[model samples]
Target: MSIRIWGRPTSARTQKVLLALAELGLPFELTLASGTMGAHGHVAKGNEAFGVVDTPDYRAMNPNGTVPTILDDGFVLWESNAILQYLAMKYDPDRFYGSDIGRFASAARWIMWENNELIPPMHNLVKHTIRLPEDQRDPEIAAASRAALGRAWGIVDTQLSRTRHIASDSWSYGDIPMTIRVHRWALLAGVDALSPTLARYYAEVSARPSFDAIRDPAMHLAG
Candidate 1:
């Protein structure tokens, strides 16, 4: 079966999907869109490489006009985390989703937590720092988000001290979301330091070939 990913590479959510694909060694086509190209009115045509999927057309694939949507063997899916889980289960189930119910459930729990708890604050940090106009940016909100993120990082640091991976002793889907967020954390405002354990872990994960291939330093939310 063929797999296609539609999104810009710099997006953290898109990185989630791409990272899973890289980990699984799945060969898929990437259709680039949004950001500069979208702003310039270049729309994606049918299944072309590096083109933006048209909104009406993309909505047909995914009702939401969001990036990082995936098409697997004609079955369309959205949500970056969900796409990661699907790729893991379909291509690398043994290692990613894990082989047993308990393991899979544990991984799923962390994925859910990352989406609901971790990503919002992380998104806020990135958006307020870079996406918003200077006059429109809210320093108070950014400060609050960074404070919350520090607490979250502390909890993650504690967990990493005890476990090599987030969900279990082995790497699983749990690493994807947290790793992506940690990359953002390294760039976020007021982040002068990270826990030693978390910093080491981030170094290890970010150094992966997959990360090196897709992560663009230029896309980092500019200070």
Candidate 2:
């Protein structure tokens, strides 16, 4: 049976899963759940209209009630990064995931850094720019988040200067998380203010077929 992906296309997490599936040449089916589309087949804005994420059935599958839950045959999983690693390891281990301890650690390091240091600011920036209405958007928050993201990107730029990719000279699970977030960033205003090194890296990764298959700006904001 084909892998069934449960989540909306606009979700960053869901996009990650889709990217991984495409990269691994795996077949899958998409079920729009979350945001405008609820898991129970209801079409409405916000989580309340459908409350799929809060429903007992969804909570049973994913305690967090988050988007992008994958059912691979009988095996079920959530958490976008974990799902990406699982798909890579199961379908295309040698190429997609890092096998060596050093490589794995390097990739893991970026994932941690991204989640801890980078995502907060990035999420805030996205929320301010796209998620929030122009009248309600907080310029202070956006400026602060943008500044923080600039600092984070500087670190990434320095790292990229030393290696062709974020984790190393080659692509690994490390690039996946950053790729999704970075692409979204580029769509926002003031992208040119970002470091050239980061721009090059984004362009290079964006050129990949897997990324092309899953890239979607519509997923970032809105229900």
Candidate 3:
């Protein structure tokens, strides 16, 4: 399969799919489109097509003009979590997605929870705390987002205390999205404490080969 991912490596959404690819040992080309390099240019707007081509020509491929889009053997797909699920089911279905129906549903449940519960608050916190200039940042919004994040983290911590992984005893696509969010949590301000279970889980996931390859502390808001 000819696989290509378009987006900056530092993007949490991009990291989700990339981490899944790495776990599955899938070889693909990565085209950087977002961040300081700004590979896609100003035409795309708002970090769109940063890693992928957003030129008038490339827009024909993905009209939404988003980063972290993928083209696999003529199958074009966007949305980070969907891409992760596709990769797992297409390549290493038995392992990453699991073979049993109950296990697969559980894995899907956590992935959905990450998208719904974790990503929004995490994104808000990162944007207000790190992405925005201090003069422009809103402390009230950041505070509210951080509180929501604490609740989300607490839920994950309780789950981790019971199970080795989010869904199953082994790693699965469910872990990818939240693992990327954990990077933002570690960098964002106002986080005085992290649950011990979460800390241990972060350590284990951070040590993965995929995490080592793409995790970028330099991309944090202070930068």
Best by TM-score: 2
lDDT, residue 15, candidate 2: 81
TM-score, structure 1 vs. true: 0.85
Q: Model 3 over residues 61-145: C-alpha lDDT tens digits?
A: 6677666788999898988777877887888878775766777788889988988998887777766766555676789988998
- Report the lDDT of model 2 for residue 184: 74
Pairs of colliding residues, candidate 2? 10-219, 36-223
**lDDT tens string, model 1, 105-193?**
87888888888878888877766766655676789888888888878778788888988778877778888888877777776642457
Question: For candidate 2, what is the TM-score?
Answer: 0.87
How many backbone overlaps does candidate 3 show?
5
Poorest 10 consecutive residues by lDDT, candidate 3: 39-48
Q: What is the TM-score of each candidate against the true structure?
A: 0.85, 0.87, 0.85
RMSD (Å) per prediction: 4.7, 3.2, 3.5
Residue runs of model 2 more than 4 Å from their true location after superposition: 35-51, 221-223
Error of 3 at 124 (Å): 1.3
Model 3 vs. true fold: TM:
0.85
Deviation from native of the Cα of residue 84 in model 3, angstroms: 0.9
